[model samples]
Target: MDPARASIDLATKIANAVSTVSAQPWEILTERNPDGGRTFEAADIARLQQIRSEYATLSMRGNVFCFREAFDYPGFSINEYCRDLHPNPVGESINLKIQAWSESHGIWIPGISEHCHDIAAFLHPEAGEDRFIAVAKCLSVDWYLNDSIGREWAPTMSPAGQANAMALREHIVEISRAMKVAPDAPLIDKACVEMLLEMQALSGHPTWFSRFLEMWIGHVQRSCGNINAENLGQVPDVFTYLQNSPHQSGLYYTLAHFEFSRDEYLDWSTLTEYCLASDVRNLCWLCALIGGLSNDLISFEKEFVTHQSQSNFVVVLMLNYPALTLGEVVEAIMMILRDLMEHFVTLSGALKNRCAGRHGTPAFRATGIFVQAVEWGIMTTWVWQTRSQRYQHARSIFRETQQG
Candidate 1:
């Protein structure tokens, strides 16, 4: 809570109040005003609601895009979401009015349908077609949607959020019990809830919902010039063995690196399913394949040992149950990487079994260590790049720990 954030929070109520609601609301804006007043433009509202489906709308591409990826598409339109809520299949005069209103309000005015101009004059009276679109695009719909999703505001309030919220209330109750009083605030403030309810129509409320779009776009361009390697912190207390035994620390760290990378692969697959490849072909392709080379691995031969080479598909899945939670890609690659590591570990044990010159494959293990450190270095970069909004301090700490 720095001065800037403090100041923003202090006057947030006024700032929030100034934001305008959509021009698209027919019954609400036309039939009824923002205040509790009423409007009876039932005919007009019905028409707009009908065509709402066909109009271009704003929405996140998918849930995957929610936490990762950046949205670069510029124009803002509600065509997508409207249809979901209300499909305006017929083109009527009021349909045209919807278009005119969109144009006047800088909304990406949809093409006029047969339903045009019943309620010719509008209340807000948009400036013109282009300006209306500009205004609509300029709306902070992205921020609003993202904030709602992240806060788990509406969705959370329903069941999941409420469950956690109840626990939270219990804590509050404890504090209250200490003082003795119960809260009287409405379950959720109406004004706050309105933002989410407003977005209920979209395919994904924050469609093309790249919350980290700005930072990721910048990172991909290398505008920030890749700072991953320069950010590996010393092995933390949790990995004390790695810190004390730099060599061993490196090995386990390497294993962890492979694990994390495989996990991201799973996340990426889940994302593809949620947004990009929602078709049959993509699903099949996703389901098929060697699962591809894991982004992180110590060695092929070492990993092969742990992997049951002859296991059938079903057994493989069962053995890899914990790994699957990593999502998809990571799971597949990890199986491979595990097999390779096990093989190497076995080879080393065999030498010790025969009372050979060396009891351990120090060099093989050593290489694994280096790989982990490097992988960790890359992860440090990825987190800062992909999750910068949520993890602001990651980059700085990474730099401090890993910088040459």
Candidate 2:
């Protein structure tokens, strides 16, 4: 056989083998549901159903700082970090506004805007009322976008599937021209295009806008690839998994949102250099790694319960380290997270000191904000993953296992 054909043959075999093995568990965990139904303990059903209400309460607890105490920067108050930002009456009004906007656009998400109050508040409390509205809109829109993209275009081995995938990819490319071309496409694509266009409008330079657009494009492709791989039951090795970390964790899009916090344009070279700096780059990688790993650990049981061959990092780790028990794999991931959190604090202070020295320079200010945003992303993600009803099954089933 030709080498290319031979390689393809091997890949297919590996995927088939993985799919077969994934269906049969070497170790038992959660109780599987019959008739291909969702695997839920009776109690878990109430938890999942009440997720929307549960989240509303959690949202009211407001934003809490995780690692802000380790560093201080001027113009950015330490007290600001310590202070709890309780949303005012305007927050409800903003939610209603966004909800109505989404409904008008044919993308209303029931309970999503209400539940994400804390998410928007946690991520961008620094924003003024109007900016917070924008952030809220983006978050609401994101829920719809993820559903449409993932549910509609997740890879399948069919002619129609290939066509849908290509169309979704092209939609991203043509999103900027969506208004001019097709005003009545799915609300998700239109909303996504509007959000990106708003970001581009706020970003004076095309370079940053272009960079963000590319990031979104890459995110869709990488995420869809993982979904496709999961469909095929192909598990990636650690390195390949880690390489997908940034995209999977949404680090780039998180940074793009942070960019809006800076009004001044950072030239390509300056931003690149700061991004490439030892502490900055390493801290980012660590954040992405921690986020990805933590998500896998949290969501593992959900996959098991659903009988979905999710390409979770813990499963990938198990594949590589065959002797490790499920408990051991959980522990290893937790240890890695603890270590990364420590490293994040240490690097945050070091980077803050360096930025303090160059405080007068634009680069330093930009770098400081970038680091702060990254810290927020990591810590906030932990809170969301742990508390969100989205992972109710994971928490109910695996929480004790993780603790042990």
Error of 1 at 366 (Å): 52
Q: All predictions: root-mean-square deviation over Cα?
A: 29.3, 13.2
**lDDT tens per residue, model 2, 1-404:** 45344434433433443334234331210112112112223443343334334323433442211222222333443344435533334565676788787787766656543454456655664556755666666666655544444422343336566567557756765664443336667766777767766666666556876666666665655554225333444445554555565665456565666656444333446646766354565665666666666666665555433433345665555554444444444445554555556666678878877778786887787777777666676656655555565555412434322221
For model 1 the local lDDT of residue 404 reads 26
TM-score of each: 0.17, 0.67
Clashes per candidate (backbone, < 3 Å): 60, 0
Q: Give per-residue CA lDDT, model 1, range 160-183, as digits (tens).
A: 653554443333323322322235
lDDT of 2 at 71: 23
